[model samples]
Target: MTLLPDLVSRAAGRHAQRDAVVMGSRRLSYAALEQASNRLARSLIAHGVRRGDRVALWLPKSPEAVVALYGVMKAGAAYVPVDPGAPPARMAWIARNCEVAGLVTCADRIARVDEAFAGRPPMRALWVTDDAADAPRVAGLPTVTWPALAAESAERPAVPAVDADLAYVLYTSGSTGDPKGVMLSHRNALAFVEWAGDTFGVTSEDRLANHAPFHFDLSTFDLFAAARAGAALYPVPPRLFAFPAAVAKSWCEQRLTVWYATPSTLVLFLTRGGLASLDLSALRVLLFAGEVFPVKYLRELMRLAPHARFANLYGPTETNVCTWYDVKGIPADDAPLPIGVPCCNDEALVLDESLKPVPGGGAGELWVRGATVMQGYWGDPGRTALALQSIEVAPGISDRAYRTGDIVRRRADGDLEFLGRRDHQVKTRGYRVELGEIETTLHRHPAVDEAVVVAIPDEEITNRLKAVVVTRPGAAVSEADLRQHCAATLPRYMVPEAIEFRAALPRTSSGKVDRRALQELSS
Candidate 1:
């Protein structure tokens, strides 16, 4: 279990003929997946991808995304998955920042991406996916269609020389900015998959449903962990999430034995009237991560599927997943339970300003240590050093610990309760944000002279962050217009709650926008 390729090999040997992935009519067994990845690995190497090189994958959530991911790792190159649906500018930013050597994308999406990174980060080659009788989008830089490359490459791949190198860099939406690439090493990803499989008791008989996007780290649990168990990974289309009741019944019909999704996804199931009639009798395990699971929803879920085991997982994209809380049932008080503690070889502790562990029930910053931590931001050493630090919190253990920047308190029972982020950063709808990023985006608005965005704790949705701005000398600025501007540039979530106009924004002696004063004025 030292690497991801080992997991694929072991599972193939154990369950060579079992259905590993089921997407509509598309079926791939463990043996087929391993063999395809091996061929793809060879194909990658034949095209000049060496060990530790960055291979970018910009594709839809199909068998190709899954195979290409394993293939990049098998070729000993770090895979960087850019959401095929992401705005071209963001994708370009990620490619340039990560310095990707090659790009694997569909013919349809080739032009935009090519145009984005054109004249910027010099990409060596483009591997275009040929779905049918499709042409090779040959209008760009050195291009080789996927079918041709695979046909020319040897089916058996040469073992690459790599150990503890990066597996993939997952770029997640920033609450305030574009997106940050969470640099995950092979060890970091493998740690999470191994722990998730063991903790959830995944077996060959288990059928897990994958609803999250391929770009999100949560999808790792569904695809890799389930594949490792020789279990069927049922790919749920984005459309099904929109109509959750139909989807839930479909899962029950498929006899899905395991399920994992963000809290919002499952809440949609209940809200859309799907859970009441569905026989989730086949579902034995249920895991919700990403955002906070409402206690009422958890209780309802337990009531609907009494025999199913429930687990709440928590972690940022930088760290795959460090902590989990097992829900036997809801607490009588109905407050969302603590995220529990670290899993497997991972460790967690609350530290004060000086990095000393706080006493039980004392509040402090949550710092995580072990194999689960990421390598840090790709290519940005300043941000990396600020996040990943070395602190001796426990006896005889001193490694580069990642300060989660999340304020937490150790309960008398020894579990840590998440008390929100230490800064203006917030997690709304399962996406992380930095207030400064939103403010920066807002400042770009033509009329916006000064902007300060803050996360206002909301009762309805965990917290709705609102932005307040000062118009430039009687400039005609409407909240609606600014919101529309955000929609065009930023993702929908990153859009401000409101854009309030003020005579003059509160400023510090140094002439910086004082967020504290803005909060006071708004209150």
Candidate 2:
């Protein structure tokens, strides 16, 4: 019923000449990539990865990384990717929680991976790289290496059934707790890819930039969409994101035709290079999502890439892309563009707290109903029930939907306009901040006693990741120093925008952050 593997199979079978994935200095045609994935899939099955098994892929963005992703799925297992750059703790967390049958990583990653999962009984890892074959150059988890076992792998198994079988176990932070898995089925994934390809005018000629981590669900489209459209997907290095000018330079050099990433990233490129410095002449489309995009920056980008189409893409990991806004021209007013119309096979509803639909122009929580909705969260029945289920729909129908937690309003044009989240939780670009996550990080600073992170809207950075962290008496660390400390522990996106020492945080009768009160004061 789903065509994910077959789509790749067909691309090889029929469109073999098309380019599948492109990285610096290497080009993989669909036919060749398909053969590589097939061989890898056979190796996985030979290693005992059965249908519906979980295969954790912890590697950087490279041709091999792409091979492992499709290979795992081709072998009929869910491919769960953990960013190679993640700290040992975060890597172990995702691995243990997802209960991966095995992991595929490079030798550079072996030491940290072994250190984290050393005690976990069910997990094993495989490494690739270096004169790996010479003199046991590979060590640590001597038992864990994929290439060594490939020869032992006897045969490739048949593709698994599409019905109720998982295609991926993409992990996203749990709304109320630690990270949890969102089970996206073959049907769930294929529906989105198919819909996105057609809806966004994605074609074989389109060349997209992949900026999101392989672990993040957004990259699912970036990776698979390339195969789906027979287009080339260029995975940018983390360094380019930091030095966006270099990225802009590469855009000109590579002739990148389409861009899909978070708004924060685009703003950096525009701010760093300005539109005039970069040669974006070949760029025809700019699709952005994962956070609120500022109107000023978008308008500037439109002017810069005058020929490129600007699109507002909105969705969550649980619901693969529910809506889109095609930037036909600058909106007459400046209130950031609406999240736009729902995609084919998708429906959006803005509902009040009681689950009643909000009237036009009234703000409420957004709920998505569609074929693209995920099966459920992995392992947690309580949360799975909360996120995936019936929500203000025909009482008798058996279909389910997802509650996005984002608040928005239906505009007069029938498009959805952006509002903030229903809670203190805020998103920076594509990453979700639990507010509590940052506060917990602040509490770790030796000089800090307690802290509260608040989201303040700004045109450039979008959400002001400001922290009102309380310091102990005579503590040495300052605001800027605290940011450096955070950079060591967390990714740059998670670092607090501004750190302010406080005597005590305000609180409501419930003694929460008194978030509303803090907002009023900040305003």
Candidate 3:
């Protein structure tokens, strides 16, 4: 299927009576989901949402959220997913940045939406999943209830989207400023989905768990792969994420055969989630990505789930998934598993600063070129061009490739071993963050003179962000006060878990901040 909506339509035709999505006690059949999305699509068109328009989806993970995703695509619009747990300011910034034409959310969250808009949102219309008499109504913008939309004609709308059309826009942290949207086309997403399906041999009998949030790229495989194979997609409740025992019980209860999530999440289950003793007999495939799986955790997990096949999938959000490594039994305590070979239709090259290939397994920046590369950052051509560059692969042979900004060493066997990033960027709890961004936000505080942020590795949490700030002479600021300041302007994940106030910061010979000194302090 070229367009993403076609996946849903074709699945509905084949698995009409089969369950397409399961959330808690609610189950939506393929036919029912298709009809629901069709009605919602018609309502969107009625409310002046034209093709190529952007629609924002802000809601807790639920069956209706899934329906709205497909509905937005069916209307020939790209859906922008906003994390419901995001601060009001972050939400507002994302909606404003994307210039969303409308919003799809629930009644309970209308207050947050209003707070985000600050009484004057740019959206032209709003669709509340549940519209009760008590639901707050905004002035000027037309409001449509879920029931009202469901009452509209269920006939499929003729949206005419092609493979080249934008499918979705996922926002990630930016090094220069706030978050930037990564624009992905239908072709980019389908390339990864088709590869995952064929690689894993997914079938209708498989039951997959949607562990990642809709805003995360990992959810793309869990959602589309299941649909492509006519399999059941089970949406794991967000609340159960903290309680490992409950998460394990839910996995067993749902009889999930395929699982995908961050390595930190899997480690949480094994340590605190009581997954080691649980009966996961039906689980056949286990996939982890987004961060480096600690060697100790990887060995322990392999011992616990010997019956399951484990694989490490690695890539940045800019490129869906470039390389994958399937675990071959258990490894030594010091051995880190390679990131493995490139997926179908993809290639990974270790190139130097001049875009020349590194020889004899030397460490260099990892660059990738493939159908899975995103089209570009939305509305930011300059930044897109910088990230996407043309590099010569052979004598006078060149291809446009994404500069991954990661350093890795190639093994003799053609496997790639990940080292670290080329910049201050780090992956903490499956989310990519720019240390300079946090320091920039910290510098905004009046009492702060200089600040440096570093990623501190922890046993339990993969990595924790720590900030060391040097206050202006005689200016006093408590950690609590600085944390509150950050919490107000930044997302919860971006906030520093630990803060230190120092009288002065160490500097290098050239007067630049000595980040290595700060690292030693954290250590």
Q: Please tell me which predicted candidate would have the highest lDDT against the true structure.
A: 3
lDDT of each residue in 375-486, candidate 2, tens digit only: 8888888988887768756656545779888888888889888777776677776687677766776777899987777787766656767888778888877888888776
- Candidate 1 lDDT: 0.78
Q: Candidate 2 — which pairs collide? A: 126-145, 465-497
For all predicted structures, in order, the TM-scores are: 0.91, 0.90, 0.97
Q: What is the TM-score (0 to 1) of candidate 2?
A: 0.90
Go through the candidates in order and give each one's C-alpha lDDT: 0.78, 0.75, 0.87
Strongest candidate by TM-score: 3
Model 2, 440: alpha-carbon shift in Å? Answer: 3.9
Model 3 poorest ten-residue lDDT run? 328-337
Cα deviation of 323, candidate 2, in Å: 0.7
Can you write out model 3's per-residue Cα lDDT over 139-184, one digit (the tens) per residue? 6778898878757888889987788888899998888758889998
For model 1, the superposed segments whose C-alpha errors exceed 4 Å read 119-121, 132-140, 173-178, 456-461, 474-481, 497-500, 506-523
Model 1: per-residue Cα lDDT over 395-510, one tens digit each:
99678888887899988887779887677677676666677778888888899988888776543345577888888986997999998777655656778877787787788999
